[model samples]
Target: MDTTSDRSRQWQWPQWILRAAAIYNLVWGTWVILFPHHLFDWTGVARLNHPGIWQAVGMIVGVYGIGYWIASSNVLRHWPIVLVGFLGKIFGPIGFLGAALRGELPWSWGATILTNDLIWWLPFAAILYGVFKIHSDPASRIPSVTRGSLEQAADAILPRPQSSNGKSIDSLSRDQPILLVFIRHAGCTFCRETLAVLATRLNEIRGLGLEPVVVHMSSLEEGERLLLSHGLHDTTHISDPGCVLYRHYQLERGTVSQLFGPAVWWKGFQAAILRGHGVGRLSGDGFQLGGAAIVDQGRTVQVFPAANATTSLPIASELRTTLQCAAPIPKAL
Candidate 1:
């Protein structure tokens, strides 16, 4: 029943529509970048009294607009970037709404918010919807993680032994519920901070009848060194250099790359800024990455995956809540 003509027609429409949307976003983004002050004036957010502040705002908005243009142009190829842009489009308006409701934001900002937020929402939504449609099409079917499969896979992938440890993950937590703290490699400052927090909260975590097991994508030697530096030498640790666990738990990078195409410069810039301020330090080797998941008895009870390394994971309380409701598993005999 399917012919070349039928296939060509099917591919033709979506591609044409996507290209049109990309052009629109590119044009709009360029406009905003070229005249950020005018765009801000139109939006009614109070004009910055300081030229320095205006310059900063212009730089930020211009960079974001360029990101939007690139993402929209290659929606299918860079779906993650497009998705992030869409998130900004949606949340930017919500933020304005909240500001207006609280009387902290001026009504004038709504005009610019309309241009930046509301105007993009429909198109972004359409692009997202189209992406899903394409993904769902019979021709484009790809294996995805469902809750059930993910739970099963998480169990299998997580319980392995590091060659150095000579101990299995399950063996380390035989007497208590394992608090598997999945972390990014040493390149992430947040991960280092998290290790410090875990050290500080060791007693509390143990009090809850749980044993902490730290997981990272570094070598066991590197992981141990980092943990020792933070005075967490006693905590059990595992190295997952290949990110096999990351893939198994569906903690892969999100849609950001679809727009900006792996932002090495941005990542480096952030690292430089962090280091300059004495706030955070990036890995000298540039192995910066992010994603975390908590598993218990083969079930993915919690995930804190981010599109980029800059964001922080939820704190201990939120992590505990996620673990508390972890799907029940059979008690060991």
Candidate 2:
């Protein structure tokens, strides 16, 4: 396959658009710095007491132009920069709309919003989506798992909890079905999102005869803090900072698209912002991916590899449907 040829053909328009945005940013930033008062006069905005602050904002916008120019060379690799720009673009418009509604900003200020934020939204969003679509198509299948090794892998991950009173995952699966949920770092917004979801649905899941066991790549104390905040203070979780169980279950590290693409940002906004599960301090590798598996006795029945770090989980009703489709439960561990 000619990857270079493919990339060249696919990226022609996107590269042009990125460069266009770079030029626009440079020109706009220069204008704002050279005559910051012109913008206030034109938009009917009140003059800022500190004009230098406005000029500094222009400098930041001009710096973003440099980042956009560099990103045009490889939009997929430099997507985080693009995402940051896009987020700014998104929030800026919302801020302007709010201020205008409150009569703090003139309606004419929308002209700046139109040029600085709205116009670039679609193109930046499209580039992000394009990167996601292109990168998500797996190039090849993962190494095959023979039954013997698969069982070994399952056993390695579901071994008895080291504490004296803790039950093994295998033992838990023996009497009923189990939902083994792998999580990223404790501080990840998506991890907090997952905790939020589970906090609401855990009882319903238990009613469906499935016990949810959370696995995290963080210290137990940190994991407890995240879970407890989300009303999951009593949830059973495994803290595996080394990711030993993650590898055994074949959860790979995330790529840039999987971690920071358009879809991730959108869903993250809903989870971390709209849902009020605010992000917090970093606890572990932010790029570590997670997954879910259904276990019955010692055998793994179903696996859902996470498409991205921020993939929204299936709701309780959906899990019930999956549980219905899973392999029959056994009687003993």
Best by TM-score: 2
Worst 10 residues of 1 by lDDT: 138-147
Top-lDDT candidate index = 2
Report how far off residue 38 is in candidate 2 (Å). 40
Give the alpha carbon lDDT tens digit for every residue of 209-306 in model 2. Answer: 88787887666676667667778766677776545566667787787689889999998888888988778776655667888877777677777789
lDDT of 2: 0.74
lDDT by residue for model 1 (1-333), tens:
222233334444444544554565556556645655675566566665664655555455556656554554445555676678678778888888998999987787787678666776776676676665454232222223322454354344433326335665555545456666666557655566567667888888777666777777667787888889879878888776544455555554434342134563465455446543113443321232455555455444566665555544456676677677756543311
Supply the TM-score for candidate 2. Answer: 0.50
lDDT of each: 0.57, 0.74
TM-score of each: 0.42, 0.50
- Model 2 residue 209 CA deviation in Å: 0.6
